[model samples]
Target: MMPSIKFLRIIVVLSASLLFGCSDKSVDQAEFPPDKTAAVEVNGSDYSIEKGGYRWVRKKGLETETVTTDHASPNQMAEHLQPISVKSGQKVKVKIEDNPILNVFLWNQSGKEKEIKLEDDQITVPADKGTYIYEVLAEWKNGEISYTFVAEVQ
Candidate 1:
């Protein structure tokens, strides 16, 4: 068997080499893009923060539980709703029966989803030329209802 001092020295040298050798591989920050990045946009005197890649701007005072509604169900709420067609850069109005409190989310053809805030029962259509599908969720004391509609932009 080796002497105690020699054994200690061998252990120290091996530990030092392993620790120092592993740290030499430092990652380059430039090679990896940030998972979230913010862009500042200035229009006139107002500035807005635009986020890239799955980040969305939050709209206050609108929240609802998302529940899937079957289109075949006799209680289908969408059957009572109407589809909308709009020109590019035009705004579309969406009115719900009884105007129940609900949350509206729009999923674009590009697969990007956004929650829209209704002002006077209207939502502005996307400026990009594409058809967008919208989902509206409403919950009441008794039960819940989900309505869907399509907005076409030519």
Candidate 2:
């Protein structure tokens, strides 16, 4: 397929920025090859490295699918807690509400649990093919409330 004109414009802009030193910030020359690729920092808790014109390490916990929800209390927002059916290499995003102090966890079938740090009030689904238990904890001034959302991947 032919490269889009917009993509070509981006390449030109990035190339010019690199050659002209448009910004005061200095990037490691050895790491970022000026010929075809460049290293850029993405602002977030997600850890990543840009190389070969692609990100080597993805920020998701699993290598495949990712899941996120908009509801801080999935139970209260029962509509958002519905089971999602996603194919391989797809992302599941649910729209709901949000909370200031919220803690989320994902429990896999293997009995291993992972703490999910919400980005834009969402979390990524695991790469496994089974039932996943999503636990959401919200803290208020008086006490804390918990919610759960389940997702099944095929």
Q: For candidate 2, give the lDDT of residue 38.
A: 15
Cα lDDT of model 1 by residue, 1-154, tens digit: 7579988999999999999877845433332222222111112221212111121122223533332323432123323434455667665554444445666677544442778886665567778876666665544443345445665677
Q: Write the per-residue lDDT of candidate 2 for residues 18-123, one digit (tens) a residue.
A: 8788564444343321112111112232221111111112122333322232423332333344554544434433232333366677754443277876666556
Residue 53 of model 1 has an lDDT of 18
Please list the residue runs of candidate 2 whose C-alpha ends up more than 4 Å from where it truly belongs after superposition.
1-82, 87-98, 108-112
lDDT score for residue 13 of model 2: 96
Maximum-lDDT candidate:
1
RMSD of 2: 20.1
Q: lDDT, candidate 2, residue 115?
A: 83
Global lDDT of model 1: 0.48
